[model samples]
Target: MPDAPTGVSRALREAPPDRVVEAADRAIRSVLGASGTVVFVADYRINGLWPVLDSRQPDAAAHALQGPLQRCFSSQQPVRAAATDGSCQLYLPLSVWGERLGVLMVEMPEEPPESVVRRATDIAGEVALALHAADRETDRYRRARRQERLSMAAELQWELLPGRSVSHGSFQLAGQLEPAYTVGGDHFDWSLDDGRLTVTVLNGDGIGLTAALLTAVTVNAMRNARRSGGGLVEQAELASDTVYYQHRGHRHVATVLLELDCATGRAQAVDAGSPHLLRLRGSTVSRVPLEQQLPLGMFAETRYALQEFDLDPGDRLFVVSDGVWGADPSGRETYGERAMARAMRATRLQPPPEAVGTVMRELQAFHADADLRDDAVVVCLDWQGPDGRAD
Candidate 1:
């Protein structure tokens, strides 16, 4: 029989975040021996992992744990390896469903048995789920996942976006923004209503505090329109007019608005000065043609024309910000559409989250300096049709 979800997390459910993590460590010790336990939580952006429990040495600098922790996370499997002190360490990926969370580690003085490892894995999953639930009540997990302090604008911007990822009956969507601590005005939002899904991506011009405000204004306006039963065209115009007039035409926001009917795979969009949409279908890569228009906050009485397309089962669509492809400030190179096309051809079969991660890595390789002047954002949509095929 399968191991029961461990009761170790039950007591921690109502406790503070730190106490919850401590309880998890204690549970690991109970199952796998009194091994020194450290829970490594994924940073908000999933770029890296950090030790969360207080018992972990302050100067631990356990950089070596990254590799095994990552493998455990991506593979959703238990990892057993030798620590620097020749002792055994067990790394269990902490996740529920396909939502990849983080990793849990326990250091044992000696190797453990299969049953011990199996129990520890089960306990870790339960703990991870509890932490996620507790997050709805406290800022402990949220604050801990942050790599650095966020500016006031960045904080508001974070609140404007949805939980980092989401899924529906037959479709999945995921998004990411880089330089999270200082992201200027990059944002993405999605909602599933009945058989229709609405998504919006925006990159407010400029950086720093003002840019963040522009993004907020744009998103809230769109949200207002969405809530009012507005169609794609109305949603775009309402957001544009609201920002353009409210900001006295002084600020603007580039955006991509989409309305997809999950039942028929029919899609419509307005490309308001953002990057062209890339559609990946079985081994081929192509850009959905778009007639770009002036960004929001620059023109009133502007009506955004809808571009119609269809999503085949198994198709993954990606919308990006100029930060991901525009020419570098140095003018020495550009991560252009061709680069994106090439990458899509290589990764068309992967899931939305992985594809987004790969594109970010490729952009880093393109710049080579690891310095991104603007916030980098990518939103991916995977649509599966009535037949349950994503073709």
Candidate 2:
């Protein structure tokens, strides 16, 4: 029989934050009676996985298990393979909610039964939860996730984000930023309260650290208002006033504030002139038009109007900053005029998480793989009805 779950939980709780992975390995080995185990975490780019090995082990090649590991991570499923010595290698996705952390590989003397596989899956989940919580207390996991050091500006923007993706009963939402290593100005945030989901996309004015600081202030102001029981208008007003006072009409943040009713699929929005909103339903894709208002901080006492719209089941909504829509390489036609719609059509069947990445890749290709001229952000949201069915 497998060891009790509390053994793993207790071990993780007692371990120092930086050493949680080591503690998790020992606890998992005891529970599964496995020969060995290794934890591989996804990098910042989500392009590859890197192993966190013990001091005694020789350095392992980062991409050695990329194919199998990626298959398991993308599918959110367990994969079992036969080893040369007749042992079994089981790869399990380590994810919490919908956010994928990495993969857990266990080598067993023999192929485990279904019951053991199920237990292993649960254990992998526990490990992921521990790592997620440990992120705040230590940089161990964060260091492992990076392929290269991030710029000071990118660091601030990244830390300000809520997460890459989130899943709820009524919808699945995911967002990604481009020029990940040196990103500036562009950022996205969201919060869920009661049955309401509020999402904000900001394209701050300026570049580098200046842009990052501008976005940071606006995001925190909005958060402060929302957390204090304020509604959408109040959130926008507070953020706008905060930015105006600091920049004095010199720098502004283009923003889109959206609030959705999960049960009814009703949405209210405020568009402050930057991110472009597109709607995809069945086989068609079109822009969601909103009255463009002066960007936040452009002037003092600028009032924002709330526009309402309804989302049907099976609808996919995408919000992208100017870096994507306005991408013009060598004075060519802008990406939004044509390329973006085609890209959206191509990703019709993809989930929001994958869709956001695909769209970003398309934007990069449009620039011939050159560094983005501006910071870019892409947010994809799929609304399933209250029944959890997508039409």
Candidate 3:
């Protein structure tokens, strides 16, 4: 008889990226004689969790996913709890490279041996790696986390955005856009080049597909320029010129293209009608002054200039869109500068991912009962300066 599938190698060999979770579930269930297995991955927005391969017909899996599963995510660790009065299960967090991806739930007839539980954790880690690898193309995974249906434009925009966060020893970056289900005209992109990390955030005015198309054109224009060996100012000009020539000053994008030297903390920024940045140091939060230039697509001859700044280790920079600060969609009538300041002060010490979520939650509550009138975005990075430290 053929040997039964086992371990990370066996599981990965048997499943495609789109079906990796289901493949993992079978592996764990076989080893533990577990009655069932379910994989819960983080939603696209990173705001909550959702289940994968919960095949129970009556929707029982949804009810089963609560309790210890939630604890696994909140605590960022593996958990063991009774699945029912007489049965026990284990929940393990799915993570890779310090990013918390989601949770794994294994329901067994009884508590398994310690050795078996340890192996399960190992499997969960492998599963996270697989999920991350397959995220971009897996409709099952993406559909599970989506809070609502996305418009065609929002779907394209979402596809262009990175996976919520990325980090290195010298710095950690996390970003989010609100009204999680539908978003348009707000996007951010990042890349590392020659020991420097480049980040660009854009906000296109107006609404619907037009704004999204403009953002797509602008970001791609910037990308093409950067690929051709241009710096921040040149990238800004290329995007601006592309928009101006294509739309004839009819549309524009507010942008901030920034490059940070992870080795030296030397920072350069080019602003095109974007909001002033916020800096948090120790326990103080303040707005750093930055000159604004004409937005992209506005004029044929507009030029953008580079602005320089310094980021000491432990300083955090907050880049946001006006929608984030505009407020009063249906809640507070204005998130206002004071409200934003208070939120920043409250979350100054949290890690980037946690801090981003906390800020989004507060904004959602503040905009209670109202549709997100505009795309709201927030991107943050903590500079660790040279020597490569993370806090």
Candidate 4:
């Protein structure tokens, strides 16, 4: 047998973002005088920016990100406003491997002599290089952790999954879980019995070990409920109750349940504050809106709602977690539902599994080799012609 696949590797997981910011601050203080300095990362697409760390003027530092900083980062050039005025305000682009990471801004009370200015430029270069190295280190950590967690989570998730992708001939289904790291909160399961296919997909809040734990609890709860021989609605209710009682006040689990009928092609879904599920049919891509509610273990006041839809011959269903929606080319904005719709349309011609892969690949491209901030997951189910053929 082939070895298990790792999710996000440990090497890519780098140190926490907070630590990276702190290191950047220390570098600034050591290189430049103690007047005041700040460091911010530029958006990947070079559109807008945001402050990752700021020592002197925190609020102002963030505000400064929105200005013409993009031009400096894009051109990999430095600006010296009041540079010639004797006062000191220097803006330098943080470039690494010919790509801009962000910028470093320094404002000293007195203009340093010529020697100091030259040294400052050199300092900026070193700082930029450091930041780049840090980012790469973080990526390595993420990849290693992802791979490890993915191997474990995939094993657990697969064992809990319905034996085959397209089972019992009534409906066709296949799902894959991709984490920004070794483990993910996103998952799916399906079982066919007595002509009904029970499909489920969930996105537990956060990622890493915590999300994985909650997911384990959730799937176990479902399994126990399933063995109780309860109907779909009853099983879901019992499972929710079990989760609530089991992890009361834990506030980090979100799940969606769907029951499909082989004969009628009808699907009944119960959504508890997860992302939207899409149904595709050639030109028309239908958006299945899930009623918003608190995640599991949040409130006794929260309730799960069940919605139903009929599947056509060529209809397709797709579900995803935050990682997919968070894929933004500009990095400043999220790739919202609209973008997901367009992506689906663009890849409509591909096979079900290939289409899903296409989305993941595109998202990786948008992030520009950057590790995801959270777990990413996507599952596609198609109900067209020959059920589970490997075509």
Candidate 5:
């Protein structure tokens, strides 16, 4: 028989967020022999403090009424208090970049050493990352349930996108999708085939289940064409026909297909009613032109233009669904390409994930944290992949 685990260890393992917070406090106390610990998660309102974990409330949730944590968030700093029991209370701000996540307070029998403070900061950072991940997970859950009748189109769209993040050789890629519904009509994908990175970002016109269905068909047709050994431009034509005939209507869709040869540093792209591609070189920003033609679903007869480019080291590619550029923050006020360019320039040196974080921060700042009503998708590609033979 396996040895029974300690009751204390089991309790800690089964702890909720507050319990986890308290556990963190206990870890800090053990390392520094502190008296108590208090964790405050900043409320969304940015007003006051709410306890996340605390030893003072053994039976209660330890959460403040969204008041105190708001204060901590507004101050963008931590507040320390010393109780009358001769215990030293230290408040530390938990933030990533400039985003104030929350505050943590630990009470000790006596003043803690500088080492304790350093250790606390590290703990706070980890807590901040975990909190963000949790929040994002919650957001996804809420999004999935926002609309009744979970559309299969939405489910299929999610499955067809890239697998989380791709990190290999000299390339780093990250993508995100936001839908106005359980399924919207925006999709982005990339894969390594024959030593080349083939990328596709498409936005189907209209909304709801119909748009999603159209997008699903478009992606499949495009994939089939590519697998059939057709070139990028040829694949676009084949995919366009497939979508048009599949839908069998005057209804049309807009799409973009890009094929990147990682080994040769050469790329070919075709934009069908999609926005101009944002290309980055060092700090310079340029656009890959959208040639003459209608969106994928908009035309029965269409001529797709092929755009080719030779990428240099450290080049970056920023693509988005129409939802992003089309999303008006406060109605009639659009988040334009210029705004994206500025954000991209600000975090050019960071990886795709960090760069995306910077971009999201800038977007929020631009709107003063106002929510973008429409679905938004953004993908950042860094072509710093291996310096292998340029075939």
Candidate 6:
């Protein structure tokens, strides 16, 4: 049999995009002496894992997230268990950076040695990278993850995201949108360049496709500015101008734009509207107050001011949209008033990737598990500073 890495790489390179999973399965079986291999992809809502390109598993069936699979994915580690036939079943997390893709299951004839386990883990990483690359050319992976069709607005919003999570030496960041399949306007984005990180949270005006289109234009405008070596002020100004010209102040996007110096922990921000920033330092949770400016596109030639702040090495920040803070189901109290602070404290022990999801779930529970009245977004960031000491 060929070496695991070489075999997997060759298989992925040779396979058609839609058949990437099948190619990886064949390579893994040949390299690891496995009887069977199945790649399970986490669904869009992340509530279940569905087997992809596996003949034995029905396409409509999803493995309820629990037991070994859940443990492996959550911990980003591999789990081993005894199979019914006195063989071994190994579950390895398939993730890239901090994005949780799913799990890889390998059924071996006997218990795997530590060496085999390590090799399998590496192979799982390769498969994940392959899947991410293949995603650009095929819809198979996307189809496998969706439980149902997405609304037009949700489809546009989702395609605009960079990714759900990213990890770097100086920081870890993650963001999520609620009412995943139907979310219309709330969005978050980030980019890291030259020891600086730029993050933005946008809550577009209006609803449905109209709101989505507005957000898309604003986000792309900001991206164009940032890519051209523009700072936070430039990004905000360009996006504001683009929106104003398009909507003529008839619509606008409430947003927060922040830039962090990874080495010094110094930060600058532009609070254009509804998105709120909260800081968690040690045990206390407090809002990071900024001079609020008009929402983007509120008027022509609206100038924005830059506000400054400092992030300690151990600090955690949460950026939330109005849909989150203003959520008052059935005329109950809003989530931001008290529940949000408590939720932030509860998730202090988790990393940003997990923390974002936990906070979103708490929001759902706050609404008695009903669909949110409006689109909501949450973004969590942990600054490690230059020395990378923060956990």
Return the candidate ranking by lDDT, descending: 6, 2, 3, 1, 5, 4
Q: Assess candidate 5 and give its lDDT.
A: 0.62
RMSD of every prediction: 3.6, 1.7, 3.6, 17.1, 8.9, 1.7
Residue-wise lDDT of candidate 5 within 1-391, one digit each (tens)?
0111232234344545334555566655665566777666633222234565333444433344334343444444444455677666677766663345567776778665666566655656655555544443334322212233446666667656654346556576766565322547777777777677888888776676777777777878778877888777776777778767766556676667778877666888887777547888878888766574567755454568788877777888888766666556666566664787788898766767556556656666666676655445677888774662111
lDDT of candidate 5 at residue 181, scale 0 to 100: 29
Q: Relative to the unseen true structure, what is the Cα RMSD of model 2?
A: 1.7
Clash pairs detected, candidate 3? 327-335, 328-333, 328-334
Q: Each model's TM-score?
A: 0.83, 0.96, 0.87, 0.56, 0.59, 0.96
Model 4, which residues run further than 4 Å from truth?
A: 1-164, 167-170, 301-303, 385-391
In model 3, which range of ten residues has the least summed lDDT? 56-65
**What TM-score does model 4 achieve against the real structure?**
0.56
Model 2: number of backbone collisions: 0
Error of 6 at 305 (Å): 1.7
- Among these predictions, the greatest lDDT belongs to 6
lDDT, model 2, position 76: 83
The number of residue pairs in model 4 that clash at the backbone is 33
lDDT (Cα, tens digit) per residue for candidate 3, span 198-291: 9999998777778888899998999999989999988999899999999899889999888999988889998899855889887788777778
Ranking by TM-score: 6, 2, 3, 1, 5, 4
- Alpha carbon deviation, residue 340, candidate 4 (Å): 1.7
Task: Give per-residue CA lDDT, model 1, range 286-336, as digits (tens).
Answer: 778888988887877888888988888888888888888673745765676
* lDDT of every model, 2 decimals: 0.77, 0.88, 0.78, 0.59, 0.62, 0.91
Question: Residue 48 error for model 4, in Å?
Answer: 36
